[model samples]
Target: MTESDIITAVNEVFCEEFEVPLKELTPESQIFDDLGLDSLDVVDLIVALQKKFGVQVRNDERVREVRTLQDLYDLLEVIKREQTSA
Candidate 1:
C-alpha cells in the first residue's frame, strides 16, 4: 500500500473505533491531546491498528514513541517496509 493508503486506513480506524471526527484527524494532530485518547484508549487503539494493518506493533518499542498522527503513519510505513523486505 502507498503512504496515502496507510494514512487513510489509520484515520479510518480512529474514526470508526474511537468515534473521532474526521475533521480532527491530521498529521500534526496529537493522539492524546487532540484526539482525547487516554492511556486505556491508546491500548485499544494499538489493537485496532494491529488489526487494521495486519501487523504486530503492540510489542514494538516504537509504539511507545508515537505521539502524533504523522508518527503513526511513519511507523506503519516503516513496519510495512520491514515486512516486505523480510
Candidate 2:
C-alpha cells in the first residue's frame, strides 16, 4: 500500500471511530489533543489499525510515539513494508 492509502485508512478509522469530520483531519492534526481522544480511544485506534492493515500494531513503547496523523501514516508505511518483505 502507498502512503496515501494509509492516510485514507487512518482518516476513515478516526472519523468513524471518533465521529470527527473529514475536513478536520490533517497530517498535522494531533490524535489526542486535536481529536480530543483519550487513552482508551488510542487502544481502540491501534486495534482498528491492526485489523484494517492486517499488521501487528504492538502495544509497546513505539505505540506511544504516535502523536500526529503524519506519525501514523509513517507507522503504517513502515508496517506495510516490513510485513510485505517478511
Candidate 3:
C-alpha cells in the first residue's frame, strides 16, 4: 500500500479509538494535546497498528519517537518500504 493509504488506515484506527471526527485529524495533531489520548491510549494504538499492519513496532526509543500524526505516518512509511523490499 501507498504511504497515503497507510496513513488513511491509521487515521481510521485513531478516529475510531479516540471517537474523533475524520475532519478534525491533521498531520500536526498531537497525540495527547489534540486527540486527548492518554498514554494507555497511545499504547493501544501501537498495538492496533501492529495487529493491523503485521509490523513490529516495539522498543522504547521507537515508541517515544511518535509524538504527532506525521511522526506515525513517517514511521509507517519506513516500515512499508522495508516490508516491500523484504
Best model number under TM-score: 1
| Poorest stretch of ten by lDDT in candidate 1 | 49-58
Where model 1 places Cα greater than 4 Å from the true spot, the runs are none
lDDT of 3 by residue, 2-71 (tens): 8889889888887776678898789999988888888888788888888878888765366687888999
**TM-score against native, each model:** 0.97, 0.92, 0.87
lDDT of each: 0.93, 0.86, 0.82
Q: Candidate 3, 85: how far from true, in Å?
A: 2.2
**Poorest 10 consecutive residues of model 3 by lDDT?**
56-65
Best of the two (2, 3) by lDDT: 2
Q: After superposition, how far is residue 54 of candidate 2 from its true place, in Å?
A: 0.7
lDDT of 1 by residue, 1-86 (tens): 99999999999999999888999998999988999999999999989988998998988999899999999999999998999889
Candidate with top lDDT is 1
lDDT of 3: 0.82
15, model 2: CA deviation in Å? Answer: 1.4
Q: Residue 27 lDDT in model 1?
A: 98
Q: What are the C-alpha RMSDs, in order, of all predicted structures?
A: 0.6, 1.1, 1.5
Question: Regarding lDDT, does 1 or 3 come out ahead?
Answer: 1
Task: Note the residue pairs that clash in candidate 2.
Answer: none
